[model samples]
Target: MAAADVIFLVISIIAVGAAALAVTRKNPIYSALFMMVTLLVVAAVFQMLSSPFLAVMQVLLYAGAIMVLFTFVIMLLSLRPEEMGETAPLPQRIFAAVVALGVFALLAFPAIEPGVPAAAASLAPPAAEAVRFPPAAGTGDGATVEFGATAYFGHTIFGRFVLPFELVSILVLAAVVAVMVLAKRDLSKRDVADDGSDRDPPPLSVSAAHAGSIASLATSTQPTSHGPGA
Candidate 1:
């Protein structure tokens, strides 16, 4: 087998494994870390497919920025282990597994079928030998960059779609502000409840109740001696 093919398989395995670990982990921090690993592996796959711009964006947006946001939210929420709660029921988990398998089959079908690639060069091989689209723009030294090249995507995103790009940033900022508001409200409510403000106090334990009863009995008996008028 070719080295490129081996490397591709290794990266694919790492991505899948990390994604699985991320989903299965109980700790939010560990899950976030594993998810970052999966995202980085996906970026590596994009780079291997000759889309350096996409790889960089994946690393920057999903792995770096988004992960940081998620971590920040997790820390702010301060979700405890008890608050994490139990896993889904067995039947629900089974149903989810079935759905996941169906999605996997849909994704793997075209790749697994030999007729598609053999019939036409629909899917190109990876690395430098891969198919190239129309040339985008020429470099300073009279070198032409292809459509899948980084320069092409960068130029298109920054030049023509700058407004949409800035709009997305604004949207992300809005989301962050919304999360902070909700978290602060929730924390205030939690603090109020803990302070016993307008909430019923906890019931006394059996031993405490028994001790109070004994103390009351003793006081009633001793008070009889001092009640000479009665």
Candidate 2:
């Protein structure tokens, strides 16, 4: 294998290990740190594939933006110290492990037998045909990579994929609205209820019951003034 391939493999392994550590670490902070490590390693791997754009995107989008968001959320949540019950039940954990293992096995079966490159090549043409759309017209830069060019300059944005993009935008807007609603406290009702002046007047019967006695007490309590000459 080429040096680049070996380096990529090493990076991939480190990324996988870091991801596993992130999942298994008991401390939330450590988990987040490990996740950052994994993202950095994955970004390095992307660079090895001659896609500097994707590498930068991986670091900027995932490592910088998403991880920052994740860590900020974790900090905000202020997760309590790990308790015994924090992890999944043993049986469920084991079941999840088995399912993941099975999926890994199924995926690796063909990969190890013939290798990933062959499998990818085999899958590409038919899948491409299935997702076929007209070639996007672009500035005559023949150097444009397939996905980047297609996604950025595609006619489908206004044509076939319009609804999907619109749906995604609506979904994002809804999420923003939900976040605002959650973060803001509605005090109008509470404020109105709490205003002492807005309280119902004392019961008429109760006021009447004490009115005479209070009036008499006030009258009796009034200080008398005698003429100075007298």
Candidate 3:
């Protein structure tokens, strides 16, 4: 096998291991970290797939930016042990495992099934027979660029999908703002609890309040105003 195939296999193994750790980790931060590793390895796989632009985006957009955002949100939430909740019930765990296995089988079957072409032409035709991309411009000049080349992807995205793209940016911005708000609210609550711990006395019980009222009534019998001055 070629060196490229060996590298690809190594990357794929790392990606799978990291992904499994990401899924099974009890700590969300660890899970997120493992997920970041998986994303980075996936980016390397994308590079091996001859998709340099996708590789760069997978690194920048997912492994870098999105992971940072997720980390911030997770830290801000500060989930407690109780909030993490008890382990899943046996039935739920079993169900989840079954579903995961089903999905794995579905994805694996197409590649491993006997008689399927190495390129999986049964599922998708050879690249040569694939539908052609709409050329960057009319056919006046015989110019061609690979789809998702840096220049081509940028032009296609900004030209055709600009509005949806902008909307997604807005959504990400809104999520960041929301996370900040939630973090501020959480911090403020913590501050109040810490600061007020001594300042706010425990509430009076009913019996204590009644006893205090009776004491006040007893002490009121002095009646200074109705004494000798009257």
Candidate 4:
């Protein structure tokens, strides 16, 4: 209800709107710019919340670094020709629009309909008035608590939940490798044959058709070589 809260809400709403536009925009460059705006607005909201760490991360990681990368990638790929092609089919286009509308409805329905408020009531813990446990003696020294020391990085690789983490890492590595391999073009087969240009030799099927027409074209295009100059 405060002025600051109202400002924060307005910024958040604009950030969400810009992000949606980023995904739906027809021009990739404009989409990237909108994404950058969304990220900057999110960083501002984080700053308003007093979380400087998250705010800095949002600005540096997303707005500065990731958005630049996205913009450069969109520029690198020559998509102008493809952009002029036909749009999505009517059935698929309608289905996607319906799904998007359904998601918006789900988000808006809760805000509009107010029921008995039983859901909120049920979320309260039954032991709300339970006695608290006193802190163990000598535990509150000036030393900082390291949360992940025993649970993760410093622990053995075979620790609990390690399998899930390893699986995720493997999946991400595989995806990176697959994308790199697929993006690469095979130029090893390109070589200079009797022709001047360095290009891949024609396939057997094409070469056979070319061979059949070569004699006829050569007879008409080039004079016959005779022993004496006539």
| lDDT of candidate 1 over 142-166, digit per residue (tens) | 2445556666665556765789998
Taking all chains together, each candidate's TM-score versus the true structure is 0.59, 0.57, 0.58, 0.51
RMSD of each: 19.2, 22.8, 20.8, 17.8
Candidate 4 C-alpha RMSD relative to the actual structure: 17.8
Ranking by TM-score: 1, 3, 2, 4
Model 2 CA deviation exceeding 4 Å by range: 82-85, 103-166, 182-230
After superposition, which runs of candidate 4 have C-alpha atoms over 4 Å from their true positions?
A: 47-51, 81-84, 105-167, 185-230
What's the residue-level lDDT of 73 in candidate 3? 52
Backbone clash total for model 1 is 0
Q: How well is each residue in 167-211 modelled by candidate 3, as lDDT tens digits?
A: 987876666555455435354464446656657443223222233
Looking at model 3, how many pairs of residues clash? 0
| Ranking 1 against 2 by TM-score, winner | 1
Deviation of model 2 at 82, angstroms: 6.3
Candidate 2 Cα deviation (angstroms), residue 127 = 14
Model 1 segments more than 4 A misplaced: 114-142, 154-230
Query: Highest TM-score, which number?
Result: 1
Question: Model 2, 1-230: lDDT tens per residue?
Answer: 99888887888899999989977765555566788999999889766756566778889877896666555545544433332123456898799899999999988787678676786777543434324554435764344434434343344455657899999878766665655454336734543355585564432332233334433322222122211221
For residue 40, model 3's alpha carbon misses the true position, in angstroms, by 0.4
